[model samples]
Structures are given as structure tokens and as C-alpha cells.
Target: MVEGEGVTARQASFGGRGARLLLRWCAVSCWLVVPIPAVVLFTTDVPWWAGVPIQALVLLLILPIGIALWFDADQHREDTGRLLRAGRPAVAEVVELELVDPGDGSADTAVLRLRISGDDVPPFEATYRGSADPEFRPGALLHATVDPADNLFVLRNLHRS
Candidate 1:
């Protein structure tokens, strides 16, 4: 809706695009690209004296990702702040829930069905993910805010422990 909302979201997402790129390179280094160079360098047996330079070089080449991730975080706060500042208030009722675990190292996700209604706003049902507050149960009422321009909403309370 607004030109800067995307910018705000991005900047707030990872201290902005530059930082995001840096972190992406970090994830790349940590999980993706490092193996390529690692294989190339260590494929052959090397003398004990060479191990220090090999490790140093690898660490030097691989450290940017760590720097990048230092700036990235779960970005709910940015959206939450934006919505709370100007978005319309609403209440969300938890209608149903399903927990989906990918079985990877990633966080387990909670899929929720919610019914949201507020003054001057028609009721609506939507499926939301676990970024919402953690403690909601079926039939629970939770605070929410809707960005009128986009109808994007965020649950106001922090999710569970």
C-alpha cells in the first residue's frame, strides 16, 4: 500500500537488504557453499603443518555468514509494531489447530483456524501459522490487529514458551 512499508519490513527484517544479503551468504557458507571449497581443499591428504593455514583460510572465507545472521531475527516485531501503531483492532477466536512438524531442525509449526471480528469490520475466517501467540487453544480469544490496506493481521500477544 505504502512505498516504505516494504522497505520498513525489509530493513526491519534483517537490518535491511545489505544485512540480509550478508546473512544469506552466511547461510550459504554454513549450509551450502562451504562444502564445495571444503571438498576441494581437503580431498587430498595434507601434512600437519598445512592444517593451520587450511583451517584459517576456511574460517576467514566462511565467517561472513555468522556476521550476517547476527543481524537477522524472527521479524514478527516489525509487523506487530506497524499494525499496533495504525492498524485496526480485532479479536481472533481459535477455531481449530493442527501441529505440523517437518522433522527437520526447523521449528515445529502450528496451523490455526481463526474467526476474526471487530467493530465496523465483517467477520472472517482465516488460517494462520504459529507466529501468533503461543498459548492459544481451541475456543480461545486472542487480540489481533489488521492492516486495512492489505488485510494482513498479527496476533498481539507473544506465542508460547
Candidate 2:
């Protein structure tokens, strides 16, 4: 997205717990089915083909989780774009944004301290992005285009930084 003037700019937020929950769900479902096939194979002389249905069932169950993960990524990008496209053209002075990773790489996030008002005024801090920015400092202001609807997003402008 183009860095326009009014929107707030920052990095993306990571989905830490949500991703874990999905992964766990996938794991548990797979585990639950593992024994069923073993039990069927050992106890019954029924053809090995009997287990195909069980495997298919497991696959069908996990499909939604996979679909949700894809949708999640798409939604994130869309939301980020929406924030970038929201407000009037304004430049928000950048401040040091801290990033935290909750082990599951997806939850890594950055909290940027932004000067919403004037340079001398107190700045606002919000959690927005999920990655690290080596160039940003405590007082270094970055030129960002913000959307008034949500001023927390900033279209990344490498040239201005």
C-alpha cells in the first residue's frame, strides 16, 4: 500500500495464541484417529481398506483448520490495508516500537510509541505490528500516512524513514 498522509503506520501484529490453538486442535484430532486404525487393523481381519474411511475422516476434520489459517492471513492483510486507507493525509512521528515473541512465531508483535500530536507533546503507544525494526529509535520520528478511522496503522514508507 502507498504511504499516504493521515493514517498511523506500524508493523503487523502476530497471532500467537490463536495459531497455537489451531495447531493443538489439529494435533489432537490426528492423535484421536491414530488408535482407531490400529485397533481396527489388529482386531479385525477386515480389509485394510476399512481404515481408508478413518483416514479420510481425519483429513476432512483438519481441512477447516487449514482453511482458517489461510483466511486468517488474508484477513490480516486486508485489515492492514484498510487501516492504511482510512484517514486524511497526516504524518505521525515515529518512536521506538518494542516487539515481543510468544514462542510460536505467529504471535510476535511490536508496540510502537507514536507522536499523535505535536513533537513536544506526549506520544501515544499502541500495539500494532509483530516484527522488529532496527532503524527506529526512541525519539526518531517517521513520516507515516494514516487513515482517520484507525490511526494506529502506518503505511511503511522506507524513503521517509
lDDT of each: 0.60, 0.53
Cα TM-score of candidate 2: 0.44
Which runs of model 1 end up more than 4 angstroms from their true locations? 1-78, 105-107, 131-134, 157-161
Candidate 1: tens digits of C-alpha lDDT, residues 1-161: 44324321111121344555565566655655445555655676666467657766767766665554543532534555566565677788889988888788787788888887677334666677764346767999987766655556766522222
Q: After superposition, how far is residue 145 of candidate 1 from its true place, in Å?
A: 1.4
RMSD of 1: 9.1
Query: Model 2, range 37-69, lDDT digits (tens) per residue?
Result: 657767888677876787567567755656665
